[model samples]
Target: MKLRRFFCLFLSVACLGGIAQAQDDAASLQEVAQRREAQLADALERLRTLRNDIEAQQIPLAQRLQDLDAQIRERQREVERRQRIRDNQSVELDTLRQRVSDRQRELDYISRTLLPEYFANYDASLSAGERATAGEDVRQYNLFLEKPDTSETDRLQHSLALLRDSWAQLESRLGGKRYAGEALDPEGRVISGRFVQTGPLLYFAADQGELAGLAEETTALNATVTPLSTSQNAHIVEVAQAGRGTLPVDPSLGNALAIEQTRDSLTEHLEKGGIWVYPILLFALAATLVAILKIFQVYRIRHPQPMAIHDIVKALRAGQRDEAMRLARSQPEPAREMLVAAVEHSDESVEMVEEVMYESMLSTQPRLERFLNVIAVTASAAPLLGLLGTVTGIIKTFRLMTVFGAGDPKPLISGISEALITTELGLVLAIPALVLHAMLSRKVAGVMARLEKASVAFLNGLSRKSLNQKAS
Candidate 1:
């Protein structure tokens, strides 16, 4: 019990000590709370000061921000107006550029195509004499267009001048115009001559009256004069001097002259047919020779009379074998050969006799058909040669066009015309060849048929005769 009481006493003492410590902690906490409350009051007073300062500044700040916002909106509106103006200017600029481009295209067409074409046509229309004067102007106009620094205005102005001059020249030439120019005489010397031009016709007369005739352009600027008769030359000189006499007018203009100039004799025409024409002509000659030979040979072939054949059969049937043989020998050579063979083989059977005569016909077949293939080959080869010539001509024309251009169709036309001449020659040669071949072949066939007919007639005579007397 005493121990229990002591423990209780100690517990009480510990509890009291705990109580005192708790009280001390409470006091210190109170002190801390009071100090914190003072700090809070100081903080709240500073906050009120800061709030008042901020509020004082906020009014002017807000007013400045509002002014800045108004300024920004005004600047944005001004920028929008500037942008609209810039867009409108862009449209106008594009329209003006388009107009400039369109005008440039028109200028290009005028300078490159239309004006050049006009000048070229005008140049073509100029006479050889007029070309002496107008050719310089046309050349100058061409140079103007070709110049890099030449302006559109200058080009157009020069073009107008050229066209005006060309038109004036044409009009003056239509009535009649006399000009002094250089002309190529027939002697190949250039002579100073007076030229009389009327429309498409141009004439030249040497100052000495030694040379005068129709003037033809050998080149764009050069004229070659074809001297007329001596009497006509005097007349041309008189006309060229007076400018009022009759100018010999060719209704066909230069056409008649051109035709006359192009004219060739048969020999010359054949020569111009080129190298292949020789072989073609050789074939023609060979075919012609063979045809003549064949025709003559065919003509010589026998046509045995029916009555002549009957007499031999009569003699053979009447036991006059020698007389029959004589009669057979008297027949034409082709028939005589076969008849002799048949008579020599008369002792044989009828089949043997027919075979012998047929063999004889076969032997003579080569002679009858001799050289016929040559004619046929010529007929077949002529057109091929012509076609070959045509191909070569086309090739030549293309080659010339490659070396020179096709600006002048004369080379192309002349080449084609010369090329077609070979074809013409070929057709001409082939047609007659084919016809003669047919006719000759027909004659040979007729002769062969006659031989066969004679053989058949002789064989029939043998059939009607006695087989018993054939041993002789």
Candidate 2:
């Protein structure tokens, strides 16, 4: 029993040793696992920190890229704006240059058309007249008496006239059929409608709203004035008389017909007084008539009772107050006004009297310049009216073209003709009106100067009389 008890004790001691060894092994494994877990956690923390840094860097990079793109877009817009400004400026400069070039070309064309060698000769002749008038004894003073050797010019004129007839012939062939019921033209010397055979003269109802006289007073002139014919002796007088009724209808014969038709149409239009040109022309005529009548009236007043300074001085020296007043009343214009004012200032001082006379002269000057503004207005407005008429005619022509597509030239040419005729007439009227305005203005100035001179002379006489009286 003691041995068995000793064996049990040994077994218990071995089991205890085994359990202790197992516990130590488990403790070592746990230590190794904890070390590995700690290292892994540190590595994971490092990776997370690196990921956050990368994300932060990406945000800044994205912002920088967006800012760079915005800068580039702004630069492009600025460049485009500058380019547009430059383009607009260039276009404006080009337009201005083109307008200047066109104006220069127009001026050149006008100068070339109007100024020829013959124009130079005419200018030289005019200069010669001016030189003679300026008291420079000109050699060409009698140029008007000397017959001008115009043979070449006359030949050219004759050829031009023949060419005009040929043009008329061609025009008649193209447009004569349209003008069947037209009246005769007084200026064109055409006999087409309303012909009346009087003894030697062939009276006709003309385009002028009045009867037209025969083309010529002499029978010999009638033969030459007739239109060209194609007979064997068409140029001969005898042939013209023999072949008057039996001649073929040459193209030249249609010249009169076409001209008469156009003249009749134009005359009918003008007589209607519907165009602006007609009223303008009537106004100009009325103005011119009034100006002429005023000129005649002024001439009558000026020539009959001219007040001379010497006569007035003698009257003042003689102390003939009643005679001076009578002379002043008989005188006209500035002289009468000055004398009346001077006589009214008998009790006044010499300076006061002189001032009164000057004031009176100044007041009369405006009266002398009466109707001058109207002339100036007419001269200035005439050209504008012409431009208006031209514009109207051009508009009418363009309107006709829009409707007709330039199919017929009659209406178009008629408008152009009216435009040209009215323009020419306006220029003609305006040029003369301007000249008359200048002349009248100069005359008024001269009259004012004469009145001032007379006033000065009277003042001098009064001063002399006062000094003499003081000395006495």
Candidate 2 residue-wise lDDT, 426-447, digit = tens: 7878888888888777777777
Most accurate candidate by lDDT: 1
Candidate 1 segments exceeding 4 Å error: 1-182, 186-189, 196-201, 217-219, 229-249, 266-273, 408-425, 467-472
Off by over 4 Å in 2: 1-266, 269-274, 303-308
Give the C-alpha lDDT of model 2: 0.59
lDDT of 1 by residue, 248-332 (tens): 7789877887888888899888776777788889999999999889888888776779998889778777878798889889989
How accurate locally, in lDDT, is each candidate? Answer: 0.84, 0.59
Clash count, candidate 1: 0
Q: Native-vs-model 1 lDDT?
A: 0.84
Clashing pairs in model 1? none
TM-scores of all predicted structures? 0.57, 0.44
| Colliding pairs, model 2 | none
